[model samples]
Target: MVNPVPILQTIATETWIPAAWEDFLTFADDPTLVGGRFYYDQGEMRIEMSPLGSAHGRDNTIVSTLINLYAAMRSFPMQGFTNTTFRKSGLREFQPDLAFYIGEPGQTITFPARSNAAVNLNEFDPPSLVIEIAASSLEDDRTRKQALYQRAGIREYWVVDVNASQVIAVEPSKATQLRRSQVLPGLEIDWVDSALKRAQTEDDGAVSRWFLGLLTQ
Candidate 1:
C-alpha cells in the first residue's frame, strides 16, 4: 500500500523525506508538478524545486554543447539526454541534468524523442556517463547522488560546479577520481573546467570555437 506523499502544501524541496517507491512514482508521473527534479534512494525521496537560475542554465548548456562537440569530432557513437528521469523502479530513481551513452554501436541507446517517459534502468543498462549540475549545494551531488549512481553501476559521473567553474569527474564503477574522461578518452577534466571559465567572458560561440580547436588539434 503506497500512502500519499504531500505536494507543495506540506512537503518541502531539497530535503529528503521517507517515501515508498510507488508513492514517489505517483508524484513523479504528475505533470502538474512542473520543474521538479527528483531523486529516490534508500527509502527516501528529495525534490529539487529550486528554479534554474542563469548560472545553472548557462553551465548546463555549455557542458552539453562541449560534450556533444567532443563526441561529434571523435566520431564516437553517443546519445545525450538532458534533464531526463531514469528509474530503477522499486530501488532508485534519478533525474540527471545530463547523461550520455557512449559506446560501440551495439552498446549505445536511443530513447525516443519527445517522449514523456522515464528511462527504465532495469530495462536499459546504466549510462556511460552521468552529469549533475551543482545547484544550491555541491555536497549532495558529491555524496548522496554519487552513491546513487554508483549503486546503479553508472560508469562515469561529473558534478559541474558552475559557481566555481569546476567539474568534479569520477569513475563511479571503479570508485576513483577521473582526471581524464574514460568514456571520452583524451578528454581531460581540466580542459572542460577551462572551457567553463572561458565561457564567463566569451560567448558560447567563441567558447565552441576554442573548445573545438582543442579536439581537432
Candidate 2:
C-alpha cells in the first residue's frame, strides 16, 4: 500500500492544496498520473488508492471490460468510479471495489456534486451498485463493507468470488432477517473460462455472442 502521508505532501507542496476533492477530481484528469494512485486525508476519513493494476489484473480487467462493454452498447450512462474516498456520517471514507451509476442515456440527474467532490455520503445517495472482489480479505468484503454499504443506503452490493467464479448479490432485509437480493440481477463472471474454451476450438465468436446476449438483456 502507498503511504498516505507522502502522497498528501506532494498534493500540498507541488500541486494544488486540495480543500475538498474538486482539486483532486480535476487533478485526476492529468495525464502524468492518469493510472496512478492518489491519497488524501479527511481527518477521521479513511484513505484510498486507485491505480490501473492495484487489484489483481483480472479483477480490474473484468470490471473495466464489462463497464466499457455496457457503455459501448449505450445501455445507460455508467460511471466507473473506483477507489475514491467518500465522507459519510459516522464513518469518514469508505471505498468500494467498484461503483457505478446506471441511468438512462442523456438523462443527467441533478445531484449535489460535493463542493469538495468527496461525495456527500450523508445524503445517502450511494452508488446504484457497489461491487467487492474478494482477495485475501473475504471477511472484510462480506461483513464490514456489506454493513457500510447498507447504512450508506446503497441499492445493491455484489461480492465477486474470483476463484470460485460465483457472484453473491446482497440487499437489505428486516432487522431479524439476513440481507439478500431478490430483485438484483446476475452476470456470467467466467470470462476467462469462456475465452479458454473458445481458444481450444472455433467457438470463440459463439461464446462471445452468448455472453453479449446475456449482457445486453
Candidate 3:
C-alpha cells in the first residue's frame, strides 16, 4: 500500500499522475476524502475536489432535471443518478457528476438500479450516459476524462462546460461530436445548452417550464 500522507500530499489535483490501480483504489476509498471525485485511466489517476458552488450546483440540477423531463415526456424509460461511482475492478473507475441508464424508444426498460455505494462495472452494465459538470475543470473533462471513458466503453458522454454554458456531447465509440443525443434520440445538445444560459438569468422553475413547453410541442 502506498503511503497515504506522502502520495496525497505530493499529488496534484485535476492532473493525471502515474500510479498503480491499487494505489488509486486506496486513495479513492479513503474515508477522509469521501467528497473527492476520482478517476482512473489505465495506469494513471486524477483526483478532483471541485467546489460545488452555486454555478455548478445550478447547472448540475438544471441539466439533471431537464434530462428527467425530456426522458419522461418522450416516454423513454430511464434512471438518473447523482455522483455515482462506477468501478471496473482492475481496469477503471469513474465517479461522474451525473449518470443515466436509458432505454430505447418504446422498449420496456428494466435496467437494474444497482448499488449506490458504487456500481461495480465488473458486475452490472455501465451507465448509458455519463455527464460531468466542468465548473472549473474543462480541460481535464475534455481530454483526460474523455479518453478514460472512451477506453472504458462508455456509450455517450457529456461534458457540461459551466463557464461557456455549452454541453459537449459525444459518442466515444464513434469518436464523433454530437448535436443530437444518440441514446435520447431527438434530445438536442444545444437545447440543453440554451437551458443552461436561461438558467443563469431565470429561476430553475421558469427554465424548466420553458423546456417542458418545448418538449410537449
Candidate 4:
C-alpha cells in the first residue's frame, strides 16, 4: 500500500480528490491528518489540510460561544463538539465546524472512550444542530455538506457566511433565512446574528452579557 500521508500533505486545502470510499477511509484514519477535515460524497473525497486562519478561528469561537451561552442561560441540555468527525461507512461523512446535541439527546450524549475518534454514524445518533463556518469552503459547505447533513438526518444546520456576516439556518430540506431555531425553541437566529456581528469588535464578555440579557428578557 502507498503511504498516503505524504500525498495527503501535498494536496491543497479545500481540494477534492476522487477515490474509492474504502481508500478515503484509510486516508482519514491516518493520525498525521489530525487537524484536517474530511468529506466523502459519492465516490469523491475532499480533505482540508490547511490550518484555520485567525478570521476563521475567531468566527468559530464566537459561534460556539453563543451556542454555549444560550444553552447555559436557557438551561437547555446541550453538548458541543468541535472538529469531531461523524461518519457513515461508504456513504457520507463530515467534521463540522461546530456540532451540538440538544435537549434530551444533548443530556444523554455519549461517545467512545478514545479522544479524537470518529463518531460512527451507525452507532450514535446525529446531532441536533451542525454549524459550518464558511470562510473559504462556502460553496462546499452550502451545497455538498448541506446535502450530506440532511442525508445523515441532522435536525438543524447553520452555515455561517463569515464574509457576509449572515447565518443561513435550515431544516432537513432547503436552506432558509430563519429567525428562530426549530430544534432549540425560543432561540432566535436574529439575536445570534447580532451577537456574531458584535463579536467582530466587542469582547466576548460583553457579547455574552448581551446574550444573557436577551435570554432573561
Candidate 5:
C-alpha cells in the first residue's frame, strides 16, 4: 500500500488550498514553508508563501517597538511574539504578524526549548492581543480574520492599515471599535498611527523619544 499525497489547490497568490484539518497540518509542515504563515478556518486554509515586503516589514517592526516601549514604560506585563502560530485542532489557527500575552499571562507565558515550534493552542491560552499589519491583505484582515480571532477568544485585535496609516483596535468579544486598548489600558490607538507615520521619516531613537513624551503626558 502507498500513502496518498495531500491535494493542494492554489486559489490565489498567497492563498492555500482548502483541505481537511489534518491535511492542512501536513501541508503546513513542509520545511520550505517554515517561517511562513498558515491560517485555517474550518476546512479552508491560507498560506503566505512569499516573504513580507519592505513596507510590511517596516510597519511590523515599528508597531512592535511601540508596543514594547509602552509596556516597559507602564510597567505592564506584556510579551510579544513575532509570527507565532496558534493552532486549535479542527477549529481555527492563526499566525498573526504580532501577538502578545498581556497582563498576568504575559508575565508567565513560556515555550519549550525547541526551535521554530508552533505554540499549540490546545496546550496554551490564546494571546491576549493579536495584530495584523495590512499592506496587501487589508480586507481579509478586517473581515475574515477579524471573525476568526473573535471565535478563537482573543481579548483584543488590531488591524494596522499601512496605506491609511491607521490602526483599528477592537475588543473581539464585545465587537466594538476602540480608540484605546482594553488589554493595555491608557494606550491610545491614535498613538500607534502617529508612531507608524513618524517612523517613515525619523530614526527609531527619535520615534522612541516621541513615544516616551506621550507616555509622560
Candidate 6:
C-alpha cells in the first residue's frame, strides 16, 4: 500500500523547497518502510504515500513465482525479491513489482547493507533485470515507466501485461541502433503473438508443469 502523505504533490509546485526536500528525503530513507515508495532528493529519501492499500492478489503471486522459477532455470545467479522500493534512473523513486539482482548485492549510501538492510536506491548495483506486472497501468508501464528504467540503466525490463497475457521486453541501444531485449541477450520476444500462442497451446496443467519444471531444474 502507498502512504497517504502528500510529498510528491508538494514537491511539484516548489511550495516545498530544498529544506523540506531534505527532511522528506531523510524520512524516505528510513528502513521501516522498505516495501513501499521512497522519494529522493539530491541524496535524501522520503516515503511517498499511495492511495491503494496492500491488496496484491493470488494472480500477482503466481506471476512472480513463475518469473522467479524461469530465471533460476536459466542459471543467472539472480536473487529475486519483490516489492522493494528502488530509485529509478537515479531520479524518480519506484517500487518494481519484482527486481532481481544479477550478481552479488552491493553497498550504497541509503542502503548501507551493514547498518541498514534496506534496499537503498543509491546503493543498488546495476540490476541485470527488472519486471513489472501490468494490468490497468498500461500506458505508464510501457511508456513513461519504461523510459525511466532505461534511463536508470537497467539492462532489461519485462512488462507482463496480465490482461493480455504478454510480456514486453525493453532495453537500451545506441541512438543510431535498434532497441530490443538485452536480458535474454539476443533472444526474440514476440509479446502479443507469443502470448497468444501460449494461451492457444497450453492448458493449466501444462502451464503449472512448465513453471514447476523450471524451478526444479
Best by TM-score: 3
Q: For every model in order, what is the number of clashing pairs?
A: 0, 1, 0, 0, 0, 8
Candidate 2 ranges beyond 4 A from true positions: 1-55, 71-74, 89-92, 104-107, 111-117, 173-210, 213-217
Give the TM-score of each candidate.
0.91, 0.55, 0.93, 0.88, 0.88, 0.58
Whose lDDT is greatest here?
Answer: 3
Write model 4 residue lDDT over 25-53, tens digit each, in one string: 76788777776788887778888876678
Worst 10-residue lDDT window, candidate 1: 105-114
Candidate models: Cα lDDT each: 0.86, 0.52, 0.87, 0.81, 0.83, 0.52
Q: On a 0 to 100 scale, what is the lDDT of residue 164 in model 6?
A: 62
Which residue pairs of candidate 3 clash?
A: none
Write model 3 residue lDDT over 37-72, tens digit each, in one string.
898878888898767888898999999999999998
Model 3 scores a C-alpha lDDT of: 0.87
Where does candidate 4 have its weakest 10-residue lDDT segment? 104-113
What does the lDDT read for residue 209 in candidate 4?
89
**Residue-level lDDT tens digits of model 2 in 127-204:** 776776665546656765666677666676777665554555666332122133322223333553353334344343
Residue range 103-210, candidate 1, lDDT tens digits: 753454564354667888777877889999896868899988899899988889999987899999998867799889999888889989998999889999999999
| Per-residue lDDT of 134 in model 1 | 94
Clashing pairs in 1: none
RMSD in angstroms, all models? 3.6, 8.5, 2.7, 3.0, 3.5, 7.4
lDDT score for residue 104 of model 1: 51
Poorest stretch of ten by lDDT in candidate 3: 109-118
Question: Which scores greater on lDDT, model 3 or model 5?
Answer: 3
Relative to the true structure, candidate 4 has a C-alpha RMSD (angstroms) of: 3.0
